[model samples]
Target: MKGCAFNVIIQLRELFNVEGQTVKIDDTVSAEELSALGGYEQYASDMRLLGKIANRAGVVTLSYAVSVTLRHLCDRCSEEFEREYGYELTHTLVTSLEDDGGEYEEDYILCPENALDLTELALSDLRLSLPTKILCREDCKGLCPECGKNLNEGGCDCGK
Candidate 1:
C-alpha cells in the first residue's frame, strides 16, 4: 500500500461496455511490506506484476504473472539461500453473481461497484501461490542424524 506502482485501481465500466477491450498494468510491489505479512520466508526483492484485463465476447477476465525472489532456510540442510519464483494467474471478473445462493462465488471476482483493486487482488493471488516446503535442491542429503553435520558436504564421523 505504501508503494506507488502496485496501488492501482481500474474502472471496469468502460471495459464491460466494449467487447475486446483490454487494459494492461505493469508495476512493482514493495518487498518490505510483503515480507511483513508474516511468512516462513522473506521477500528479497520487489515483486513484479505484469497483467492485462480484457473483455472477450462479453466475458471480462483478468490474467497476470508475478515474479519475486525469496530468502529461505533449507528445511533439510539448514542452509540459507535465495530463489526466484514465478506464477501465472487468471480469474473471471463479473459485476455481480447471477444467484444470491453463492454457489458460484469462487468461480468469479465480483466488482459490484464497477471498480477493481488490482493491488489487493494480486497480493492475495501471490500469497496463495507460495510453496509449502522449501529446499536448497531436490536431492539435498540433509543433516546427519547422529552428529548433526550437513550430509551434503561430506560423510559424518558416526556413519549411518
Candidate 2:
C-alpha cells in the first residue's frame, strides 16, 4: 500500500494528452543509502508511466503501465550497462464520497476526479526493482591493476 495521506489519480485525459505521458522515474526514488555490491552503482535513468482510466464497481480506476532505464555496474568488471526500465506495474487509488477503499485489486481505485501522482508511482516501481548488484557488461573484463586496461578490449599484461 502507498504510504501517503492521500493518493492522487491522474486524469486519463491529461495523461493521454501527452505524446505518451511518459514521465521520467529517475527523480522519483530516494537512493542516498544503498549497499555496495561488486564495486558498482545502480540507478534508474528514465522511468515513465503510461495508461488510461476506467470505471470499475462505480469507482474511477486508473490503469497505468510504466517503463524506465536501469543502469548497473558489472559485478565481475567495473563497467556500466543500461537496461530499459520495464516498470509495468499499475497502481490504483480510492477517492470517493464515502467509504475510502484502503485496498484494491487489479490496479483499481476510487478517486474524486481522475488524477494521480504518476511521477511518484513510476519512481516507486523504479526504486523497487533497482538491481542490487550493477553490472557494466554481462562479461566485462574489469580493470587490470597490473596495467590498468580493459580486459574486454583484449591483450592484458596482467597475465590472463
- Top-scoring candidate (lDDT): 1
lDDT for model 1: 0.81
lDDT of 2 by residue, 49-117 (tens): 455554444444455676655566567666666777564555545554345444335454344554566
User: How do the predictions measure up, each by TM-score?
Assistant: 0.78, 0.50
lDDT of 1 by residue, 1-160 (tens): 3544445678999998899999997977678756554455588898888989999999998998888888889989999999988888888888878733555856488899889877677767766776677889999999988899898898877954
Lowest lDDT 10-residue stretch of candidate 2: 30-39
| Runs with alpha carbons beyond 4 Å of true place in candidate 1 | 1-6, 36-40, 99-107
For each of the candidates, give the backbone clash count. 0, 18
Off by over 4 Å in 2: 1-48, 58-60, 70-76, 95-115
